[model samples]
Target chain A: MSDPGTITDSGSSGEAPVTMLATPIRLDYQYTAGLSQSRFLQGIAQGKFIGQRCPACHKVYVPPRGSCPTDGVATTDPVELSNSGTVTTYCVVNVPFQGQSIEIPYICAQILLDGANIAFMGLIQELPATDVRMGMRVEAVWLPKDQWGLTMASVKYFRPNGEPDADYETFKEYL
Target chain B: MADSEVLRAPHVLEYPYVRSVGPVIGAFLTGLRDGRILGAQSRDAQGKATVIVPPTEYDPVTSADVGALVEVGQSGVVTTWSWAPEPKKDQPLDRPFAWVLVRLDGATTAMLHVVDAGSLDAMSSGMRVTARWRPAAERVGRVQDIECFVPEAANP
Candidate 1:
């Protein structure tokens, strides 16, 4: 038998290089509540906006809270809310998130409802993206009356009220 | 983009939140076990008086220690507001509703909260509101213990 350890290069050959590949991953978060946010979820199941009040300051908070920002004590009362509001400031959500419901290039807006003082975040719908603007009067679109639940998704999205567009100066402060 | 041979694991990160409170906050929590609301004063800082639920022991801007802690009423007015058309897992009102900035009767500035009204007609600036407390059995040291505010009276 020939020598077991023998170098056999198949004629003329040069060294070859090595390479590696990678993939891009996105972030997805699922939240669980011990207590505070649970009330917000409860309200959504029934189709309502909830807020907490600071007993020290007497300020009512939307997305009702467990703790008051001022007094630091847990608020006791739970208040229900109206669904209508005005657009305060907003950004067009031309981009899309994984598992998103609305189509890409939709609008994500900040709306200031008539009675509440603070702003909550959410999406707008039913109207063309170009038609959305700050101070535009919009109304909530419920999830087909029977399908309501304890979540913000209870209201499908906001729709245009057909009023003339609000002046930019009127809502610039909210941005 | 698709490749049959590709295999990868996603990167994940978690961070802890560290919060420090001054004297007012300490007293405010003391009040919670007893069920009370306290607001701190801006002795060195000039501004309208405001109520603090958690009782900020120190002025946010001046960083001065607020010595005087006082009780606040449960009613207030909407200073400014916004709506959350959709809520995530644990917002106060699971349904669509507005978030408002409320300035209590004696306070100068505002705090945040949610309101429950069926439509825009149900809400307005200066609308009076009251706190809806959670049951005592559910009381924890946290904020959501109060729940969300509802309209005091039906809108005309």
Candidate 2:
């Protein structure tokens, strides 16, 4: 091989004809889950909700990450979170896609689990899609223990928790 | 907690891509599919003829248009190598193998490929090796068409 640093200034002599061929490639990859995420997933499997507290900001994160996005510091404190929380926002999904497990017109909501600073998205069920709204309290509906594993899928979805809508002032920061 | 353990599970991601191999590379790949190895003919700044295996369209040193297509021998010498004690997914072989740079008989540059020598003890720089091509029926215009290289002495 030629030294990569050397400049090759010789212009093409332009002597030969050109042709193109089609080539297709397929690749597969496996990614290992990191520490914080793995612990969160394990907690879900055991019917427990866990969050990490950023030592600097004191903000709690459910589905904990290694570092605090805001302060750029490690979140070392693990806090158990309540399953019921308020929906900070939501969207109605009407478009269909391949291999979709749910029907069209489902509600995907972002819930701020009680005691956690960050919110996570989950499917909303039981109530009419149009009735799902911000500030509405919802609780996780877990699958049977036998079906639990190292996956968030253990929580089938979140449904209305029968609590009155939380005041906007209570979850305004999460939105 | 200091004593806490992290959970893990297998996850697979896959994607399919299509690309066009232009004139120079197209010719090379087509040659592979047809059971032949082709090299690009080029000259250095001093006007010395050089044949680069797995041909590049232009001369690497002078950037001159490559001269012509040349057929090279299947046999080569391992210029250097590293051992893969446990094969990863999609590697040429499942057992231990050596990832080597081989300089084909008539080529001036080396190409990278795996050498399935069965044991690390048999692999070394300067050892003679030959392309162990897949059966004609299974030949695709891709690099894997040559399943891997094997020690020349072990060739049947």
Candidate 3:
């Protein structure tokens, strides 16, 4: 919070070994991932995408919030979703600010993975920002097994999967 | 694919924001680095001259443009205080300290700061205190340039 916020990190030998801003405050928390989410994150740790199916409505939610919003029923049924998905929407980042991990001219998209009813945010990469479009096909780019953790960082980012863009009519309900 | 046990994810919410404190606050912090306390001079509803330490760009009372950055007395009275018996790591003092709102002399408004009196019994409202500064070399432009306020000699 003080002058230390401006200090550029001195990395370790042979590595960028940096804690972005080690400063006046660092908060720690042991977050308990609920039943449905625990299973979802475990699947992510194994490079598998898992969604929970609602008992009544039957809608599948990846990274389930434990219950269905409509039916008010617990989503206990597990559904394994494919790594491939469609970019339901996207935004190109141009303006820059301090502490931004990504550079200018990058794309952030909401990806609706196949077999899941809801869409989630993902970073889109490996192509020019202008090429990105709504309903564009994309797939997960995962980190190595040793680098995998209980966090979403296991999947580095999503890139164009060479599949044709999905028709807007098929995803209009999700939009 | 589903695990019977709930997962425990260790999350660290790290918010490292770099913000521009703006011209008004910038001057005040710069003054602290130079071993001086500056207050923003403004007028109240009745046009009475009022000064505030750690000032805002606009007057707190009248919401008018402030006039000048004037030097104020380093010594001040603790308007109110809450004692931290077990200090947190990020606090100015690792040992016990009192978070005090000091109305620095010549300033109508009180500024929040810590008073490093020996113990809880040593702190009270209306107690006089003076700035304890870090060495000139160590004084970066920050509120912490003053290590912590200590009991003024006049206090009894």
Q: Residue B36 CA error for candidate 2 (Å)?
A: 1.0
DockQ of 1: 0.01
Q: Considering DockQ, which of the candidate structures 1 and 2 is the better prediction for this target?
A: 2
lDDT string for model 3 (B1-156, tens) is 344487876778777665566666766766666677778878899999998788778887888988777778989899999999999867799999999999999999999999999889889899899989999788766788899999997333
Chain A TM-score from candidate 3: 0.83
**Judged by TM-score relative to the true structure, which candidate is superior, 1 or 3?**
3
In order of TM-score, best first, we have: 3, 2, 1
| Global lDDT of model 2 | 0.83
RMSD of 3: 8.8
Residue A154, candidate 1: C-alpha displacement in angstroms: 2.7
TM-scores of the models, in the given order?
Answer: 0.41, 0.68, 0.72
Q: Return the top candidate by TM-score.
A: 3
Worst 10 residues of 1 chain B by lDDT: B1-10
lDDT score at residue A58, model 1, on the 0-100 scale: 69
The fraction of reference A/B contacts recovered in model 1 reads 0.00
